[model samples]
Target: MEIITSGRLKNTIKYLRALFIIGLILSIFFMLGILGVLAYAKSQGAPPLAVPQTSLFYASDGSIIEESHRGQKRYWVPLSEMSPTIIDATISIEDRNFYRHNGFDYKRIAGAAIADIKAMAKVQGASTITQQYARNLFLEHDKTWSRKITEALYTVRLEINYSKKEILEGYLNTIYYGHGAYGIEAASKYYFGKSANELSLAESSMLAGIPKGPSRYSPYENLEKAKSRQKIILNSMVSNGYITKKEAEEVYQTNLAFFKSEDLGRERIAPYFQDAVKKELLTQTNIDEKTIEMGGLRVYTTLDPKLQKVAEEQVAKNVNPDSEIQLGFVAMDQYTGEVKALIGGRNYEESPFNRVTQAERQPGSTFKPFLYYAALENGFTPSTELRSEVTTFLYDDGNSKYTPHNFNNYYANGTITLAQALALSDNVFAVKTHVFIGENSLVNMAKKLGVTSDLVNVPSLALGTSTVRVIDMVNAYGVIGNGGQKITPVFIKKVVDHKGDVIYEAEQSKEQVLDPNLAFVTTHMMTGIFDAKLNDYTRVTGQTITNSLTRQYAGKTGSTKTDSWMIGYSPQLVAGIWTGYDRDERITLTAEKQYAKKIWADFMEEAHTGRNVTAFKPTEGVIGVYVNPDNGKLATNACPISRLTYYVKGTEPTEYCMDHVDHYEEVEEKQPEEDPDKDKGWFKKIFDWF
Candidate 1:
């Protein structure tokens, strides 16, 4: 019995010594681990923290317009923007020692190791919030030793360099929460159908349970399992002192109306405009595709939702769907050069081609305004006469003889004032003016008015034979509508980067390129198209639609065999539309020919609704005069018809209409018919008295 006892004592001593050695080795390893972490943290630099996120587009009214992103559904919100409940719940469930730990929780690790040993399988995890974040950011979710060691390294570096709040924010923003949702904000929105800031305690607890096992805990997939997990989350919250035990119980019992819907899955608004903004982002910033998709840029645009809706409505209502005629429309604030509305085609979905800024169609007679403005610049008054007869113009040193015909081959066959010709849309008169002023005059004027399309130095160019973009035409019209100020269409007002920093902003400026007086006169000249008073041999081009007009608008209608264009403007807005077949098919239907004027009239009248009805205000350097439409001279009472004309301060016609004056004088000067009989004196006088 004594020998047995002695042997047992020795064995027990050996056992205790083994334990002591093991303990000492563990202590040494722990110290080395700490020192290794310190050394590694000192050596490792921070990696980029930014992840790809959605870029948001906003309208002028601060309403969300679009969301652009790559496939991932991530949105970065700062810690301040996140709800406190979410922060607390996440910390309570993810890493209780999130604030106190250097990188890992040794106590938690030991507990998990015991748990795994008791289970005889890897059934538990001991990852801290920082460890999980590091794994998510830099390593894959493999149980391999290499991945675990790498995760450990990253966690130490993160804890050493980044603040706790930043680390928590990044983890919350990037962690997957099922249903394609990444981050707490997205998950909150997905499950609760509300922003993270708006989530209730129950909703917060419900979402906090998702990141652990998305497919299993997602309310959308298995509400029972999700509710089961919610109890655990609330219990954890109670344990972490985030909530009282009773509060946790109450939250667990509360029924939640889960809204597992996503905004990213909804139909887009203003699809074409979104595309345009995206394009502008691509070219304007010159950034890579990955950045654009993930840049989280906030783009503020000049899109006026009301006006855009109206523009879309007018085009859809006016266009014939079966006719296969495509259309492009643009509306801009003439004063500010803001493109308020746009349509690339009859249907953007059918064809993605943007005719507004892409397709170049012949301007036809709408090009007359630019020519007339050029004439005004070159000392041509509104009363300047051009023969409306079909005439051939010889240019290129008389080597080029071009004979242009009027609309329907009809002409005044007599000289007509510029205003009269404009009203008639007399093509012969326009070409003649184009030739008289030199072709470069029109080209230069068009450039001044913002026509970027190629305009060749040819006589037909006068009659708008040159093809120009609808947007460019509208922009040029903005110049006239803004009283001769240089203008260009501005799509984006401001752009903010992923960090909410201003990256780009459109510069606002106006340069007066045309004499304000001449521009006013030019605008006045366009008004003739709607006036029947200026009709000579032909009715005013806008005569058919004049009854629909509510306010004074200046614009011209141009029709080629294929294309129909109406470009008009007021002080408030300038818009242009083009309607025709894609192949330039001749518009044989009468309805097709009338589309421009009708649409223009309706759009302008509706767009101008509720606004102050004011005529195009003239500058001080201009004066108005009543002139004879036929003779282009100052009008007198004897004249049967006169038009209120505008001209530069001293450019008004000096001579009065002598034809009417002379006729009136001749009638008054003629002696009475009975003068001869009266000379028979007393006898005739007595007979007359009887």
Candidate 2:
């Protein structure tokens, strides 16, 4: 009786233990199922899949300048546009049960699980087409269990949200292939030198094998290994009924010709300029950086391809190639402030530091125009005379002393007119005017003329001791060239997304900031910088480029110990050039000193080849008069150095120059010549003199 009771109690305890084990297993599964459902709920509002497309930069005439993609070099194509063979090969090799599975193929999973259990590790993949697409689109390629679980949940969401065709299309267009390619089309071109739609069955099968292991399966990397992978793909294609056994064997036996051209490599067109455009796209528009690189944005830029080519050629031909000297060049439309062409550095491959919009160097005499413009607004004329001799100033209640000197420590040592002062880049005249107009006036004028750089209110600021960007200086010069109507630099004219919807269009902003008449007079005065007649103890800064110019131009040249700048414009265009070392080494080379001027001259002349020569028009308040460029006095036949100068109507010189009277009379007695303009009409003579 005792033994029977003990056996019955033991059986009862065994039954209870079995019941607990079964209940625990069921509870674990139920919790896992709840977590899976929650994950699906979380993915219900997943952001739509965004396939990266190359952002194309188009020139004003619709020519492609660059195809900008941050990382993935994908040329997106819909599945309908893809070749049927590539599709079939891809489907066969990547997932055979693709069409029948909802998200997970239970049969493949069970087989993979059995294999993993046999090996006591997770190695075999049971991912279907939907599963692989979900992983590629969103998740990382880590093989951790948590990652696998997340990938599974995402797979479920993708299957529930999208159709099979959409999933396959996204997968084909977003997968990585060898040789910097990211999609089927790019891979086709990179490997076969043909479009995806034009690929044959043999080409398609070979490409279909690369994505599994790019370096291991790429024909470019290893032909034998790629062939082996290709054979497997073709066998699978035959098994899947995509091709007959004989067709598969024929494709496998064909000795395929590989693409060996360099034409399809990444194009580097104006790399520095493209950097600036990308920056502007992020800051100026409502678009994000990712969208600019991957949303297939069509950016219609103000770039002039002809001018861009000319700019590059000029820089390459004129700049000293063997030296460490760097240069920056930018050409902009004066009327609209459209940036036409840009070169940011000497060599883009060696260094990508953009000097045009990034580096800020001392502008030197290029800043003089702003000071002189302020003077013109404050009761100063082109004929206003100032002592150009070396001088010291006592500003700040005579506590601070500043001495300004011209290049090479040379000076006129006598009175020079404002026109001649600018022509020779007389430092004394510039500082004197800066003080007279108050130290802060030039800074204010620069700000109004589209200068965004910081400017210190000091006496040397008149001499351009303050550093400024080449783009800002060029933009300011555009204002002067466009009759004082200030316009900001415009890099992109409009932008359109991939859907053909206009995203951003630049609005041309023009504001009347300076007096039109005074601006015209200032512009005319600048032309004297190239006129040899204005030469004094110091030669005109732009005299070196004078012979190279074909059309009428108003220009200024600026120099410091380490920087050389040339900013100038015609009626149609404005440009700036800079040359110096990145470390600000003192310029001792003669060629380095003149590089900016030569490049500016070459680019401007060639860019304006077919364009009509347009002369600057003076307002009604301004009048053109022949004056002694040396003294700014009314011109007489006696004056040896005379030029057609513009001035506000009342500012015209009434007194004729008497210094050359006796000199000319002595010359007349020795040898008299007929007056070239004596028989011409007034307007005709003025035009001919110019």
The weakest ten consecutive residues by lDDT in model 2 span: 663-672
What is the Cα-based TM-score of model 2? 0.75
lDDT at residue 68 of model 2 (Cα atoms): 73
Provide the overall lDDT of each model, using Cα atoms, as 2-decimal numbers: 0.84, 0.86
Best by lDDT: 2
The estimated TM-scores of all candidates read 0.89, 0.75
Model 2: pairs clashing at backbone N, Cα or C within 3 Å: none
lDDT of 1 by residue, 1-690 (tens): 445687899999999999999999999999998898779776977755656677778999998777665556667788888888888888888899999998889999999999999999998889999888988887388889998888888887888788998899889888999877778876776778777888788888888898889989988789899999989989999988889999998888999987756644665566676677778777877766767676777789999888888887877777776778888888899888888888887767788888888899998998998898888888899899877787877888989899998777888888899888887888888888887888899999888888898878888998888889998998988898888778778889988886678989987566779888888999998988888889888888888889999889898999898999898987788999898889878999998888777777788888888999989887899899888999789887777998899999999998777777656565444423565564678877888879
Q: Write the per-residue lDDT of candidate 2 for residues 36-89, one digit (tens) a residue.
A: 786765667553554667788998989878877765567767788899999999
Residue 20's lDDT in candidate 1: 97
Clash count per candidate: 1, 0
**Candidate 1 to truth, TM:** 0.89
